[model samples]
Target: MTSHQPPLWRRAVAELLGTGLLVSIVVGSGIAAQQLSPNDVGLQLLQNSTATVLGLTVLILMLGPVSGAHLNPVISLVDWALGRRSGTGLTLPDLGTYVVAQTVGAIGGSVLANAMFEVGTSISVKDRATTGHLLGEVVATAGLVLLIFALAATKRGVLAAPAVGAYIGAAYWFTSSTSFANPAVTVGRIFSDTFAGIAPVSVPAFVVAQLLGAAVGLGLLLILFPSAARNTGDIVLPHSAEKTSA
Candidate 1:
């Protein structure tokens, strides 16, 4: 089945809405998990991860045809880096637009979640700036990017939604920082002083770690799929879809 790619304006709106809803799911579910399982931290995590997995899967499947469902800046940058020369990937202007939309949408999502939960919008006080947490972020993001591109390179793009969701669900449990793999989501989490929130001071280190992880993931992609042809556009677009770079 051929997929119709929307115009840049519509695509950007999809990214904005997709990213906003994704963060709302993350922060909203986290808050619910906390409230539902006040005593058991493990149960809270389980609940949060489950909701995130399901939510992310739905979001990707729903928006992949539109904007490539690039809810993360790193994904957009990587797509641009690998495909810019091919003239099939994202252009410089597209990158800037996607990043801005994702970031602003993320912050809006956080506020929306806070309002929903009757939690006043406030900066997170929970500091997650330890070295171990930073390392965990690096690992989490690297694995995420690797999983995404690997699927694309191997012609397993059809599985991108479920695989990406499953990896993130697992990463939440295994990673020390609970794997805020997306930079936009990380920024959004700062607006909620609830279960999913991260302190403002911790944001910079986490973003740096994620960027480093993206670099690492790109290197690994080169090594692992040396002869694999690069895919154009976003990390995961709907199968057989054609999209013009913004």
Candidate 2:
């Protein structure tokens, strides 16, 4: 850990707060979209995607310095996996804490969004179960991972905030499942029945697909950037004080 880096507890808090705000943005915008564009599915999607893109960019930029803003469990895990051999990135215990914080934060965010919309906490009933949807999730998650790590690998980490947001916005339109790429977000969406919600029954398959996609993404990262050219410090925050040789 870098001398300037916050202690583990503070970093964990940042992760929790960041992930919570991210999910709140997703669920809140989805609810607002449904209300503003009642009958137009396309318009609703556009609204949701726009909000998500802008919100995500801001969130990453704001929180990256604190916790690397790994709002997604998969990103944290992937960072650990790639950097473990070099003892540069997240430790094994950090991985567990980050994932737990992200998951809990996401669930809290969903509930908070629902409360804001005057919708009491409720389980999602929207059943999104199909091979095509599952495949889309896999593709979406894979692309997301590829984009983030690719930026890190190529030393373009500064562009991650905007690039990641833009890719997710595009994936929302292109993917059949609307790109629920983060496992924590997927679990969070189960708490709402609005446009962004996913039924409990469908959560398992989506998670499995996301994990598989992450594996594929890791493989691609290894293939495309096999050397230890990446700076581990740039994995999460572009201008962070930490510098880990790779």
Candidate 3:
């Protein structure tokens, strides 16, 4: 790691904790919205999306200093991929560590949300795999990747917290799948049988769509900003591990 980067263990812990809390915010707020809004699906979505927007922004601000607050597998993978030749982002082993941490954290967050809501950890029966929903996932993930890298490339990474949160909040309404753009969060939602859950059978397609979206986003990012590769290390937000360690 570089001077600005924390050790792998610390970064991993940050990723795990940050991702866990993000899912908790998502799943917990969704459950609350369902109970609070009862029959009004629109109201429930509004409540859920609002809470997610604010909570996600807060999490990114808080954890970005530690691990770039990636909190998403696709972001980490893209960071690694983009910086491979430049050697400015995560290495292959670091990517593996990040993915494992994020996935485990996602599952744990779902379980935590279930417990908090007095619901058991049950597999979601909400089948979300349709042609339209799959297309939504593609769009949602693509937009997310494009936005993050664009900010980095443009030296606007400092605005990532609010910008990303706003984009996701907007996507919640525009997309059919509610923009479960993060693979880790997508898997986490599988453990909840509530409003934000997804059926296990839908996971593969969703993941595939997300990966394809990442590719599209990457292509767009490279074309739009030829210097994106050099700025890959600043994803999500910029922070110094050495500064924090001291």
lDDT of 2 by residue, 144-208 (tens): 88888888877878888999899999999999999999999999999999899999999999999
Backbone clash pairs for candidate 3 read none
- Could you tell me every candidate's TM-score relative to the true structure? 0.93, 0.94, 0.97
Tell me the deviation in Å of residue 150 in model 3: 0.6
| Clashes (candidate 2) | 0
Where does model 1 exceed 4 Å of error?
1-4, 227-229, 239-246
The window of 10 residues in a row where model 1 has the poorest summed lDDT is 237-246
Candidate 1 per-residue C-alpha lDDT over 88-188 given as tens digits, one digit per residue, 9 for 90 to 100:
66778888898989999999999999999998999999999899999999999999888888887887777889998999999998999899988999999
Report residue 178 deviation for candidate 1 (angstroms). Answer: 0.6
After superposing candidate 2, which stretches have Cα over 4 Å from the reference?
Answer: 228-230, 239-246
How many steric clashes between backbone atoms does each model show? 0, 0, 0
Tell me the lDDT of model 1 at 44.
91
- Displacement of residue 52 (Cα, Å) in model 2 is 0.2
